[model samples]
Target chain A: MMDFLTNDLLLLSDSAVRNAIPLLLACLAGLYSERAGIFDIGLEGKMLVAAFAAGAFSAIAGMPAYDGGWEMGAWSVWIGLGAAIIASTIFSMIHAFASITLRGNQLISGVAINFFAAGITVLIGQHWFRMGGQTPQLREGQRFEPISLPFAESLKDVPIVGDIYYQLISGHNIIVYFGFIIVALTWWVLYRTRFGLRMRAVGENPGAVDTAGISVVKLRYSALIITGILCGLAGAYLSLGTAAAGFGKDMTAGRGFIALAALIFAKWKPISAMGATLLFGMLEAIGNKYQTLDLGFVVLPGQFMQALPYILTVVILAGFVGKAIPPKAGGEPYVKER
Target chain B: MNKNLPKWVDLGLIPLLTLLLAFAVSGLVVLSIGQDPVEVVQVMIKGAFNPFGIGHTLYFTTSFIFTGLAVAVAFHARLFNIGGEGQAGIAGVGVALVMLSYDWPHWSIALLVGTLAALAFGAAWAAIPAYLQAKRGSHIVITTIMFNLIATAIIGYLVVGPMQGEGSQPQSERFPASASLPDFHEIFGWFGLEFAKHAPANISFFIALVAALLVWILIWKTRLGYEMRAFGHSEKAAVYAGISPLKITMIAMLISGALSGLMAVNTVQGEAERLLLGSVEGAGFIGIAVALMGRSHPVGVLLAAFLFGILTQGGAELQFELGIPAQMITVIQALIIMFTGSLENLVRMPMEKIFIRAGKGATS
Candidate 1:
């Protein structure tokens, strides 16, 4: 009985791990900027832009050789990822400028960014790619390949839990493991370091931080920039690592908000944020799993199941698990009076 | 600095600059893709205003006006109600169910039922956040957005599952004839205006107009409106003034949600006879922009909604005539809104100076 339970959990482990990476990376990205008192609501827009850029670049890189151009698909994927990071980073600057400098409302700026990204990406794809706003599929070697653990075979027949080890250990993309490491690194940087302390100080009371010789604006800007880079990587993973293609309209699909919820639920702490992300991941996994298993009873339609995470978010937010407070001065922009 | 600039120039600057920037950016994309940007604009304008075009634009605007008002009402109370899409949608379902079941003669009954459903559902949707704010102090913005997602999923499931229409398109069945509003385009066509023959302009537009006016009166000339505005300014002060933030939020959200339901009537009663999977795409979200541009006031909202309605209708015309994707409207709308919402900050320096001068005058 113990062996069966262990095997089942092991089998589910890979899916859970795969599901958690995107949210984990995004929440960390959000944690960095928001921790420093700047609200980065444009994470969704940043992700969508990067995903499209990476997909288009990869497609171009892998396209059939024409006009004496080198037919180098692998090189294009790398370049595409790099371009995605740059493109998203540039887009993040708009939010930075609006909130950090002009002190505009962060929510409005973020929503506008979301609309702008969705519209432009769809328009460009339909007008250019001619695939009805979808990018061409990348050829093998052009997309990130799943890495299987070789040692899993050696451990498969050792004991009652050996099969569990094999299923849980093998056949996941490279980015999944890296995403976990990033979460840990993010937690360490957010809680255990001098920078984290300053960020917290800036968020709670930027005026105080400023009085103590820290440039509140500079810290916020740096945090936003860091967020930009992380969001780019998360977007790349969505298209390049998981689905391995171009994006659809609203592709980030409010995942940025989900990450934000995770951020708040964890009380702006990176490690707790990981816990929150996993809880979300578990929701998503169960939603997907329930679609396949009728469980001897009628289930709600897939659409309802799909909305489960968002509903759970609302419920949790509405005191289902008590309340989650944001960084004290999150939405309010700092305006130093001359 | 000289005060030679026109009073309207300050307002005009943000809109004009936004247009210029959007066009410039779109022009770059057009140039890169080997399409003439000027040609695209010309096509859009021609498609938008050619007599036959205005009717369709009006038809689309009827719905936007309601959604815009819904967002604007909540804005007055300083609440974010992103459930406009869901509220409008669920209310649409409510209308569909009523039409499918009832045999009423007066369209008023159906309209009442639909509107009430929208208000009830929208209020319920928003109540989650209100309760959180009252009890646990959660931000309404974040919770409302999450509600939007849940609303989308729930509505999507309903249409595809229990509410599936006779057609295979994962939609609701055709609403009964009694439920539909009178089509005005047909009346105009009887006067030899062939331009109105194809458009779906109906009595719903007039209803929407009256609704907007009524909203204006309720917001500006009423005691409740004063309390709402006060709540928006400061919750602590509002509480001190004996205004219950919780009650105001709930009332505002219900009114907002009801207005969003009217959006369904515009579509189900006037244009489409049934509800589709993605009926009220982003009107709820765009209404935030409308409210912002309109400054959450009724008159401002109407103008903003009309302008956006024209753009939307024009984009649909472009899709039919020039084969351009309708998504361009989204980009343009986003650009316009982003610039407009940020315009207050842009003119803050000048406003401050003016205020300072006014203060000096009073002192002197």
Candidate 2:
């Protein structure tokens, strides 16, 4: 019973980290955009489009040489990642133009972006691949392969510490490590850097930032660019880094919204965002592990587990769990004083 | 800055121009895909207006009407009710529960109770988000999005577990024959008019029309509507005048949610005769596009809903005839939303400039 429990713990923790990477990246992406007073509900859309771009480009680049076909090197994944970043950044620019330049409703602009991504990805995917809106299955050389740490194999039999290090802390694709690095980078950028300070100030008081000789539009645009790049990484992770062969239609599902929930649960803090996403990820891991988990007294349904993150977000938003105050000028477009 | 143009410019001309821009962009997309834009349009119109296709078009129009009205009602109070999708989905379960409870003796009685069930369930789904927004200052958009996901999980659990049919599908058993709503074929047959036998359009279409009429009256002809509009315009000003923001928010959302719920009567009780998973099929999101393009007016919503209904039915035909994906419609819908909802200023600014110049020339 003890051995089985330990084994289950290792497996669960391993999957939890894997699942949390995309959410973490997206959550941090939201952090950058929302901090700059550009509320982005389109994170899911950006990630989805990026996923499609990455999958499609990588599949094309990695296609083997035939009578007339061109073969590419294993560096195809980098090309795919670059395509994802470029596509997502262009998509984010649309939101920036609508919400910033046109001074339109930010929420409505975000909604449009989401719908646009959802539609365009599938339309282009089907047009290119003709696989019913799915990219071709990526092979080993075409996708991100997991990298085992140097001591992971030797450390596997070294009792609890070694097992924990081997199972929970090692053998992940490069993006997973990048996700953690981004959490740290995000913390540094949001709290430490001068640009970060101005970005936060813009979200809280664009008028003040404008008065202080900073261009609110430039700050907001730059913030959204960062948001776009991070979302692209998250999307690439979903398609190229994960076990899934390639991008499928609507594959981002609701992770964007879930990341938004995590952002709120963290009260816009970076470290807490990690914790919140990990908790949600663990819930997802548990749900995937058991169809219906049987306890001594009651059986917990998987649906309940799946719904818990959303329920918790509502509770937090309602101040039952805790108060979640957003940035003051979060959803409003800035107009210069007349 | 120019406010000298007639109301028709704002109401009619701007939306028309915006729609044209959206269609132009969509045409470019189609052209990029190697399909002739003119041919695509021809096929779409023929497919949506043919005798057999008109019924499906009207059927789609009925649901769009309800969801569109739902979003429009909330828009009056400045509340973005994104939870229409979830509210409608949960309402399907409520409708199934009521229709499956017992053998009702008549279709009229079942229809009445089923509508009430839909209204109650949809309102209940919206209630939490509304309450949070009212009392706690939570952002309604985020909360509604979360509720949509949760509602999906709840419906998935119910349909697969307790509500599963014997045929191994994740759907409930069909409601009793007596509980089925009258289709357009039967209703038109009573008047000696031959309608398509398999068209899904039904008496629920009439319900949607009635709902639209009632919404018009409620929004334009009532004291509550005045207060809701006051709150929507400016919360600070409304509060100074003793209009309660909380009251307006809650009432507007409840009404909005009920309208969304009413859509289930068309899909679950009228067309499918059973509660199927994914019955809403993104109609809730489509409501946002409808409301935006309609300028949040009931009559405008009706027209927009009909237009979207044609796009939907026509897109299905495009898929069948031209090998183009049905998502082509979604792309068009998204463009419309972006242009009409978010980028209205793009056309409005230029048009306002032109109109101002024209008005000045006449005066000079």
Candidate 3:
């Protein structure tokens, strides 16, 4: 049991943290939109397109090859990350235009954006690479190599603390480290800034925000843009780190919705959302592990682990667990004078 | 902005113009992809309108009709039931259970039992989300969305685990011959006309029509329908008028779930003759677009479903003949939904002003 705990569980915890990065980023993405009164079910789609952009662009850029230099010289990976961010931000502008400018149903607009992203990524991908809508697997130099912390090698002699530090925290891709920074930054922007106050107020009561002489449309658009950027980062993280190999159709695979669930489970706070996403990721890691764990008397199917997050979401939403409420003005288009 | 134009403009002309705009955008995309946009249009028209194509179009039309009405019913109650995908998927399991269990001597009995099973399973699947939304103040959209993912997992388990057929395949054994719905060709043969063997259009087409009519009556005539619409329009007003929000939410979703389940009768019973994974094929999500385009009316739902049916069948032809990818169909569909559903005011507000000016000039 001690060996299992020391070795098996440590590995699982590390994998769980790695897996949680995209979900955390995506949750933060969703936080911006819902907080500012736009409901975005399109986060999955944005991330998908971003992943495709990241994979496809990096492959093309790094085709000439890279000599090992600083951090393995994976310049294409960083470029791809940038490409994903720009592409998703531009795509998200569609949602902003529809839900904000047109006074359309935010939910319907979001669904359309999801559809648009799913189709466009595959369409463009198939046309460009001709690999049945998939990007070619990245060569070593094109991938984000995990970075070991400075003390990760030196601290191995210490017992549990060393194991936790070296095994758990030391060897994630830079994107994973950026995820923590993103969450902290999100909390600061949402709780500690005037813009955050206005954004939150707009979600709660757009009418009040309008009365206070703030531009509701502009603020909402800003939030949408931030949503796009964060989702782009999530997508970049997936193709560059979690996947770190290639892009395929529907690759985001419902992580966006899980992020939305985390947003709700966290009650829409960035810090709590980080915690919820990690817990969700932990369930997924355990689920992946259950398939291989040797249990003599009991068998666990992979689908059960896969289904747990959704089941938990339903239970929580059903008031069976605890109360959670969305921003009051969410899913409603703000009309200047109604 | 104009308040009044002939209702025809709102119901018919607006959708048509938005469709034109969507096609125009799609045409640009086709051009950018190096395909001839004009050729794409020609292929779509020729492919969708052929006699063989009509059968397949209506076959898809049948499935969309059920899902569309399901969405429309929920819309009347201001509830977005996007779980039609999962509802119809699990309903295939319900359909398979009844059809495979008993060897009914007659197709009618099998049909009845299968229909009941599908309805029960779909309704049951929807009930949890509906109950949560009603009693717990949970968002209906999220609960239903979660249910869709769960339904996929459940069906995956059931098909591979408990219900796997004797064959090596994950699918169940085909239902006995008596369980099969009569093909449209057979019905057409009764009139001494030949129909396409390739297309799977079946008598579920007529059943879908009946379901649409029933939904129309339910929404426009029933007291419960009045209450549902009342709550949808204004919850505060509904509270003042003594309608229970919880009751309305539950009943609307139940009815919606039943209609969505009815789609399995077409896909499972009429077409595949067996349950399969992804049998719903995003019809549940497409139902949202259908409801939006149709304005959530039964007649409009029928028309919108038929339009999408044309696009889908036509799109297959584009793939086969012109080498256009199938994802283009999805893009076009998304553009249509975007333009008509969300960007509606983009077309409407301008058109409304034009109509207002035209009306004033005519009066003057």
Root-mean-square deviation of every model = 3.4, 1.4, 2.8
> Scored by CA lDDT, what does every candidate get?
0.74, 0.91, 0.87
B91, model 2: CA deviation in Å? 1.1
lDDT of 1 by residue, B137-180 (tens): 77777777777777777767777777888767778887777777
lDDT for position B254 in model 3: 89
Rank all candidate structures by their TM-score, best first, as comma-separated numbers.
2, 3, 1
| Model 2, residue A186: C-alpha shift (Å) | 0.8
Q: What does candidate 2's lDDT look like per residue over A138-239, in tens digits?
A: 987779998999999999999888988888888899999999998999899888999999999999999999999999999999999999999999999998
> TM-score for all predictions?
0.91, 0.98, 0.95
Runs with alpha carbons beyond 4 Å of true place in candidate 3: A65-73, A292-300, B1-3, B357-364
* Candidate 3 lDDT for residue B293: 82
True contacts kept of 2: 0.74
The residue ranges of model 1 lying beyond 4 angstroms of the native Cα positions read A1-11, A64-70, A159-161, A292-300, B1-33, B187-195, B320-323, B347-364
Identify the candidate with maximal lDDT.
2
Per-residue accuracy of model 3 over B156-275 as CA lDDT, tens digit each: 777777887787676777899999887878878889989877578888889899999988888889898889889989999998999988889989998899889988998898888887
| Model 2 C-alpha lDDT per residue in residues B1-364, reported as the tens digit of each score | 2368768898889999999999999999999888999999999999999989999999999999999999999999999999999999999999999999988899999999999999999999999899889999888998899999999999999889998888889899999999999998999999999899889999999999999999998889999988988888899999999998889999999999999999999999999999898999989999999999888999899999999999999999999999999889889999999999889999998888999899899999
